[model samples]
Target: MERSRIAVAGASGLIGGALVRALTADGHEVVRLVRGAARAADEVRWDPERGSVDADGLAGCGAVVNLAGAGVGDRRWTPAYKARLRASRVRGTAALAEAVAALPEEVRPRVLLNGSAIGYYGETGGRTVDESAPPGEGFLPGLCVEWEAAAAPAREAGVRTVFARTGLVVARGGGAWGRLFPLFRAGLGGRLGDGRQYWSFIALHDEVAALRHLLDTEGLSGPFNLTAPYPATNREITETMARVLHRPALFAVPAPVLRTVLGEMAGDVLGSARVVPARLLESGFRFAFPRIEEAVRAAL
Candidate 1:
């Protein structure tokens, strides 16, 4: 498919920054929606909290991707922080959806790839789940439901809306894996909790590629799991990291310790969601690093 102009919200984030670089390197024009003033040709000011966006800036774009949201693991799960998490995702998505919906048909983007997460499935334990599975219980699941629902305006306006239900992004720089790299390098890395909870992870390289696939593909709409085919247990992941980094995986953080240290967020950290990219695979998307070892090496 030929590259087209795409507008991206949260373009400063890990995935968004990588996506922008990938798109631009491939000759696609990208316009970023920024919270600050538009100081560059590629930037457009937007405030999701106030529900304001420069619609004129969005005009003529072929696609819009809204990845605006608070980093789930960036802080402790205090009531206020949890509220910010919900507000950031739900409000930002709603604002973007409304902006796209208000656009004239001639200039409206064809597709809207809104940000979502596999947390919708809650704690799937050892059981595997695809997009077909219904939502599970808890705060994360409920928050995900609201996050996806906030994009209804775009879908209702006949935009080809898709939810990129992302999994644990295994990257070197910033994410859950970011904290792991230093520890493992110092030979202090170990499994969290019982280390048996399943973790569905994807390489940063494949995550960007999958997003592009969703953006460019035709006749594709709805939720797609952006995860690898194989789901590894936390213990397996620790072993892989140790083997790859030549470190010993001798230590383990018990579940009680995790709860004490991470507070409410510990539940999510230890929760299992054995997710698979069923819809993405069915859509003919291919992953560059599908295995745990490959993904871990790629991150390094």
Candidate 2:
């Protein structure tokens, strides 16, 4: 593969961190967009609030990836926090999109991979959905609608903008799945709510690979679900974790308890989204761990 200079926002994040290492290992020049002073040679300072970014610094880049956003499930959803979540994504995305647009057309990157989430589809009950499916109901779907629209500037500038609608990333140390490991290993693990809500998941390694795949594959735009091929229900995940860890899965977390603790965010916790990576499949992308057992065991 030809080496290229790629600029990335949110380089401090899990996916962003993984991507930077991968790109560097593959012999690509990776420039990071940082909020504070440029800490290192490859970092560029940018403040989304002031609509400022080192556009000139990004001139020669071959691509840009924006994963800047606050954690949705990180804290209690106060009205203020919700606004922060929206602003963090929409404002940063708008700024990055505009920055990518400001580059001289001839020097502009070939593509812009914007961060998105399967939350765009809301709760899908038991029905399977893919990129072609229309947006579903709830605050998340509406937020996603605005989130993707924020990337219009890049698209208008003739950049191939891709909305990577990510799902639950299963890993050992970070993300939600990581938090569940200890509980399940101690035999205190249990299903959430009815344990029937489908959780579309991807191993962390696969998630990173899929992002790289999107970067290399041309003729692909719009939303692409980054999820494992085989989605498992909450009960399935719980059972698998317990089995893999040699523990007992004998408890259940009721919906009301989750609602009481997580407030509005509980809906998403108990929500069902049977999402599949249809676009990626059609584009010939493959998953490293497609089954729940394999995915859980790998995490352990």
> Per model, how many backbone clashes are there?
0, 0
Candidate 1: 10-residue stretch with minimal lDDT: 47-56
Question: Candidate 1 on 1-29: residue-level lDDT in tens?
Answer: 47888999989888898999999999999
lDDT of each: 0.92, 0.89
| Candidate 2 steric clashes | 0
Top model number, TM-score: 1
Candidate 2 TM-score to native: 0.97
User: What does candidate 2's lDDT look like per residue over 29-142, in tens digits?
Assistant: 999999998878788888865667878777878999988888888999899988888888888888888988988888898899999999999999899999989998987898
Best by lDDT: 1
Give stretches of model 2 more than 4 Å off: none
- The TM-score of predicted model 1 comes to 0.98
